[model samples]
Target: MQRFLIALCCLLCSLPAAAWNGAGHRLVAVIAWQQLSAPTRAFVSAALADHPDHSRWVERAGGHGAAAIFAEAATWADSIRNDPRYYDAGRGEPTPPIGGRFDSRRQRHWHYVDLDATGRPVKGELDRQVERLSRLLGTADAPDEITYALPWLAHLVADLHQPLHVGRSDDDGGTRFTVENPFSKRLPFLSLHAYWDELPGPSSLRGRRLQREAARLLSEHRPPAQGDVDLWREESRHLHASAYPHQAGSLLPIVDEAFQRQARATAERRLSEAGYRLGRLLEARLRHRVSRETP
Candidate 1:
């Protein structure tokens, strides 16, 4: 509960309606995982097997098949952030991704790169990690590397596409600003970042049903022109500038139907775009391994 409030504080100043909630992440994951080549799917499954949450994912899978695992994997980074044990005092500040074979803690900063409010891209661990993991996936294909990279890749890709996650030199991605409840009554107000996060979908999308929703979304939207992080960053910048306008002093913005419609459209499209790009990235990197036997 303490961690929840801290995250709530960091996620936004007011009550948290959403900060890229799990249902949205799972929707993005299911859409991407379904498009994977069978070999890529197998590779991803095998990789996720090493995740600390794997057994829990399997148990939660129940009758829904592996879709549950895909969804659960999408939320693992966020789960670890909320987990107190990972934040135990022994772990140093800035929380590095635990190194070596026994490492269990997550690298908190790996999730999002904060671009300056002026929109200059601030280089972050996310960019480096994505590049490194993509290279390893393409050439190295080490089992341990694959196991670690896949989850981070999935989480980070979705994270990059979130508009606020890529913005603001100051503020925890707009966690500093607050707004009236136009999205939902669950919270009386929302932080600017949390508002964008909630734009993707409801807080809990009922597991397997979200997969079906992902499929529907895919049918309606075309795949990305191609996956490019630069393109993703530019896309985020536009969404932030046009749709999420603010005043000089940080007064709260009013959330009305017009704003919600535009944000919702952008978020859904981004979710689909992120998903297709994830599939493309994985397929490009992992397809070479089809002929090699699993280690």
Candidate 2:
């Protein structure tokens, strides 16, 4: 178990600092938060008021308002990973058993599913969480339940768009594939996954201007035509096979200018697509609820 965890961290490190990382997740949430109708925004904000982190959110958000709270909440699923308070007291696992029937256990895997090089399937938590979230919302469950599930839904939708999340890496999701960075001063030790993870650029991208970036991207692009979850995964798979890194006899991935531009473009496009889809998904869910309640 210890070895498994060590490898997981190493693999995670191989990913870029921003790919489905804090900045990326925040960007997705901000985008969705911006586009949600006033009614949907009100509903989500009210549901989120019951979150265990509401006090902390208030502290962190300061005067940023509910949108900031909602954006930060998008990262809660990832944040719980470090907080032992969320862990089961007796079992000492990160997943604490809520009174609910849902397998609120194993919060980490909710972000992604990985496949092997041989094309054998590995169970990912994202699909399971999506279905669970649907049922939770469909039944018109309490806000507390929706609050618990909503973060996962928002986050997983963004994670679903990260090519590395869906694509199989030869080196444990490319945690092993080292990179020769384009920056002349840098060494060739960074992993390919790490390189792609920063596709949106730096961690600084997660600031007050993230909304502007998301808005600009939205203005520039349209939602992908084939936008189903399954198709999204397949698109990632195609990128994994063809778009990730170009091999040129180097033991590590040596990213050239051309490759960097193409890869960055792909990542940017995916972020736009993710934001659009997440907004649409939330809007559709709200519409569904309204339709159901209208009778």
Candidate 3:
């Protein structure tokens, strides 16, 4: 394995960040957390408690409750993109087990899939990885794998809902298409993908504001049906047509108020749907295990 975050670093230098920023992922997490049954939430909390980066999540949460911890856990997959302890799982030997524990290689490609014009995945492994990880989590005797997979499942379920995560390979999910946004001075110019990533809200979102945002989204968008992973990705792919803004009389596309409003609305609805789907998925996958193991 490459010691540094090689591929992720290269992608970060050239492209925008993950499918959703920290806030978007956390919002989805909180929304899901709100919907989960008590047993499932307990099981989720216990599984995450065994994670290697659990301490890091606690520290980052900064004296928050279990909800905050779960929310932070949702972003762990993205947070490790730059962490030194995790390395890229290159074509090297499989990461060896340490003390009989599963390895923690950073599989950054798990966040998105690049599709060809025919909708075949040209690159990335979002759907397949989620399915593979879900199976691993469902197994009876894989504590280490469950610990590892929980965070990834939390992150990827939300990612597959992002339109550009299922985007075309021609522009690398719109990362090649630059856009200008005069509304925010901090981000005047960025890729269309990055602009969509930030539409759910600021990366620093947390506490009451995060709760309010999640509540608002859940209220506006009713709990979506429990769609399969492939179905979720297809839904996102269908939304790609409207994800990009029409370029006005300028060389670069500028995000106008109307487009931003529409994008934000779409993003919030997607986030709500992802949250409910994740909650239902976790309940189905983990409830049986919890019932068998617990009283």
Candidate with best TM-score: 3
Error of 1 at 226 (Å): 1.1
How well does model 3 score by local distance difference test? 0.82
What lDDT tens digits, residue by residue, belong to model 2 across residues 51-146?
667677666555667777777777777766656556633466445444333344435556666677765437455555665675676565555667
TM-score per candidate: 0.84, 0.80, 0.90
What ranges in model 3 sit over 4 Å off? 1-17, 91-100
Q: Which ten residues in a row are the worst by lDDT in model 2?
A: 97-106
lDDT string for model 3 (1-295, tens) is: 2412432343356565477999999999999898888888888888889876788888877777788889999998888776666677774455445335756577878888999998999989999988887777778486767877888899999999999988789998888776767777876667888888888888999888888888888888888878798899899999988898885524457788888888888999999999998888888888778897655
lDDT agreement of model 2 with the native = 0.66
Clashes of 3: 0
Instruction: Report the error of model 2 at residue 235, Å.
Output: 1.5
Q: What is the C-alpha lDDT of each candidate?
A: 0.70, 0.66, 0.82
For residue 143, model 3's alpha carbon misses the true position, in angstroms, by 1.5
Comparing 1 and 3 by TM-score, which wins? 3
Residue range with the least summed lDDT across 10 consecutive positions in model 3: 1-10
Give Cα distance to truth, residue 242, candidate 2, Å. 3.1
User: Candidate 2 at residue 177, lDDT?
Assistant: 66
